[model samples]
Target: MTTTADPPQPDDAGAPETDPPAPPAGAEDPATSFTRQRATRWLEPHLLLRMSLRAVVSAILGEYNDKRELMGEIEADGFLDLSTPDGDLWIDYVADLGDGFAATYAVATLLSRPELEVAPQGGTTHSTRQGRLLVLGGDECYPAAHVDEYENRLVGPYRAALPRKDPDAPCLQAVPGNHDWYDGLTAFMRTFCQGRWIGGWRSRQARSYFATKLSAGWWLWGVDIQFDTYLDEAQLSYFRRIAEELRPGDAVLLCTGKPSWVAATDDDVEAYATLDFFEREVIHPRHARVRLALTGDRHHYSRYGASDGAQKITAGGGGAFLSATHHLPETIHVPPPRSRARSKSRSTTYQRCDVYPEAGDSRRLSRGILRLPFATPTFAALLGGVYALLTLAVGAALRDPAHGLVEDVHAMAAALRGADVGRLAGGLADSVAAFLLCAVVIGGAVAFTRDASRRRGRITGLVHGLLHLTLLIVVIRGATWLTAGMPGTWSLALVVPLVFAVGGILAAELVALYLLVVDRLFGINSNELFAGQAIPDRRNFLRLRLQPDGTLTVYPIGVRRVPRDWDLRPGWVPGDRERFAPVDGIVAPFLIEEPIPIPRTAPGTAA
Candidate 1:
């Protein structure tokens, strides 16, 4: 093998210097920079070898698995035109997917319609044939920003959508979600820059939360509530500045990842803690002429009112995991002079607002009305009833052979034989006991069926069902033991009860398993499965039963398949239908001008 000689080094004289003076032996080479050293250390043989092997394997196998993803800056081309013919703006609140994968999906959906227009509500608002879209929250990749991850997860999907850039297309504004700061915003800055390096501005790498003037008078402010913590001094000052800049008729849209109030169960402490923080730090200040405060991360849709006359809208339903059904509390603040209170629940929906320069009638202008469904309580009750009945039936069938139906019959026959007077007397008592036991079973079944028909939730139905099943098993076993011929020893008497207990346990287990499957895999509550068919097409209306207090107690109607045009008047007493809102414009509040008696029957008129 032949080796090439090293290149000659030039000295101060511009000639090759032989035997140049050597520096301190321990000193590092002056040619090596800190960056080079750091890079070398990071890419040491052990680390590089491991990463390289994994990468090669992934490449060969066509698998690009990595937790950290870098969704590159979404180019202007990937967005669809949402500008209305008259040019109304389309604002989308999206969040919770790391690496921008989910955000890209939501953006694509909005862009799919090209006929949409973008218009400004405040200032010299103009309507564009192109639809303008604004992203409310969650624009960063999750966990950490790895360049390759962003490319594959975020950029790839966005490119696939091929968003268009309309000369009048709505401007895009974004707020940083919690994941953006995982690695100190390094990846976010690089990816959002679109291959251009952004210089440091105000100690932030140009990409940290900034506002853009979308329209002449409307200022859209995006705030980054870093790591779920309260706004820092810098961020608070920034918001104040933005607020001060707002004009009287201007619309201010504040965007964040977390909602001010979350719907949660009584047992969930974490959610309540968050709610407390939001109330004190954010909602209390009543800052800005907030047209809308949009948020995500709850994976549901909800709208609440702020004291500032702003609507706090949660738009977290962007095709991620659905959240729990939320129920609004009685104490929840409702806007004064409202005809009806709004329900609080996590819903999957997108909102459209039509704001016209406060022209003519303010009400007619339709200020940011949200069109979404409230999860009906009727459905919950129906599910509860169905699950209870099915589980009870299954439990009965699985009863141990030794203690169930067969044993009861055998004991009854023994008592009737009258072979021995003492035995006959004992058998007679046993027979009566058995009869009462069966009655208990019957009672349980009746309670369960009645509660279920009334459409109680799973918790109530479950209690009734389990009680009935247990009572039924116990009664059957007791009858069997009483009717059987007297055993000489106590040990033999124990057998019958043991058999019954074993059978009952088995039945209970099966019922529990069935319920688990219904809840987890199918998202069906057991009550609904066993309950009778749900009321059809009346999702928006709550079926109320009259109470002594002269108030209406609303019940949910679970059925979605019922025709919207169907009349419930046949079931309603005469004149009851007149009290309800007319079918057209049913969204208006029900005005009770006088005391109207509750209709005993369903409404005869079509709703």
Candidate 2:
């Protein structure tokens, strides 16, 4: 494979002085429009609650009544042909981006630079030029895809990174993740599929899904699985037409929103089944090989490679919260050895290789869950309210009609001073409504457990609920003893406030502990544990180069920590490249692991 030299361009040269024609109204704004801001706080109680509700709505209504079906009607075909003057190609692959301004801008600034000096592991440092084509695998915006959010979190930072139009500007294409679909892909289509310019990079795709002919004998297929729903007739038909152009021995790079291969290993087979069917029925028949697959829903970097040299990589670490990599399976059989899904594709074993942040760092970071009370005070406050409600319920359920607050407190204390705690619990069970409420609390905890359909998942949830329930009992009894000694109604005023403030912290801490325990013991709640942490470190992205001889070299670049401060560059324009520069100096990105080289030829096939 022969590499071509792309001479670096000077900062002041190559870019046009004026902006690309004004974007459509409500479209993405250029970088200079907004100031850089902090990353999203995923664990904020309000955000978590809102996102949970949005997810439920999306699952029930969004997936079934897909927006993609309607998009097919407006767009003629989902294809972007970029195959031109035969030569080497450089491409940038990033996913799970568009969170905080600093993290997103950091990656974008690096991408915008003419070339980077990357330090590959155990090898001499080398310089690699920026990609001419930028592929956003999925989840372009965090939380939800809305017009304003696109401008703030995503568009503004990216435009700032590469502000002006340059002669060698890259082209941008994207696939929607579940987050983007939360808004029914309205903002996503406006941002990427409208054939507008995103910063200096051109948006050429006309539909949510696109088949890009990168060059002769090489193709890049960006498919929209839309919440892992089956490929609609329109999407299937579009790809089928693209397949018609494939010649024998052609190579393909698949870009999808989710990592179906990883999902299949966890017994969620629907996504993997659909992907497999597409390969067997639509691609394999044409004798075109899917040499590589990329996805970004996980917010981490992981590669699963088969003996045949096909790689399925998850590199979602563009700018979102850092996801844990410790729980990834060491090996998985694609489609599972024994599944009911119909498929002719042979079962291939993919072994996990090169996980970023290393498993140890992931575990160390999980400890951050313990800081939940301070990090997410909103969630902590909610927990406090729940505790207060439980306390009121217990007091009401045990209240004697003839007794007042002070009298009732003293009476209950005296009556239960020597009585067994079980007897008190049994008395609460006497109130069917009260018991049901308690049961609901337990069930709610269990519901948060992943794979709730499985016994282990249910048990983990039960344990989580029981811990909270036990805390409630202790707080109630402890307050009874302490306040029984205090005189009058004053105790009531003091206790009520404490229940909301102090109790909240206790409940939140209990949840954090539960998450840490379950993640280590059962490999559950890893996402929740880290989402609570909202870590902004360990960011990464992939830069790929396709040589003239048809071989691909992947540089997995990473930043150990993102810079938090930035200074405005001198004489920067609204759409110029150097709008914001890191005040502490640019943090160099290093290769997380050794570079992976994949020849157009497979291990057992002839070139």
**What TM-score goes with each of the models?**
0.36, 0.90
| Tens-digit lDDT string for candidate 1 (285-322) | 44323345566654334444433334555554332232
Estimate the lDDT of model 1: 0.34
For candidate 2, write residues 1-607 as lDDT tens digits. Answer: 1111121111222333233464433243354476555777776768878899888887876756786776556434435555557657788999999888878888888888779888866777867888878999999988788878877888788877776765556888888999998877878877875556677677756577877766546788988988887788878887897788888788899999999999888657555888888898899898888889999999889999888788899999889999999989999887777667755477889999889889999999999999999988988888888777666555555555545667876444443333346655654565666587778778979877876248998888888888887776666566656655664354544555567777788889999999999899888888888888888888889998887677777888898888878877777645456677788756679988777887666866765
Model 2 residue 318 CA deviation (Å) reads 1.0
What lDDT would each prediction earn against the true structure?
0.34, 0.77
Question: What C-alpha RMSD separates each model from the true structure?
Answer: 23.5, 5.9
Worst ten in a row by lDDT for model 1: 196-205
Residue pairs clashing in model 2 are: 39-100, 163-575, 163-576, 163-577
Question: Which parts of model 1 have CA positions greater than 4 angstroms off?
Answer: 1-92, 97-107, 116-130, 139-145, 163-170, 193-205, 214-217, 248-250, 263-287, 306-309, 326-607
Best by lDDT: 2
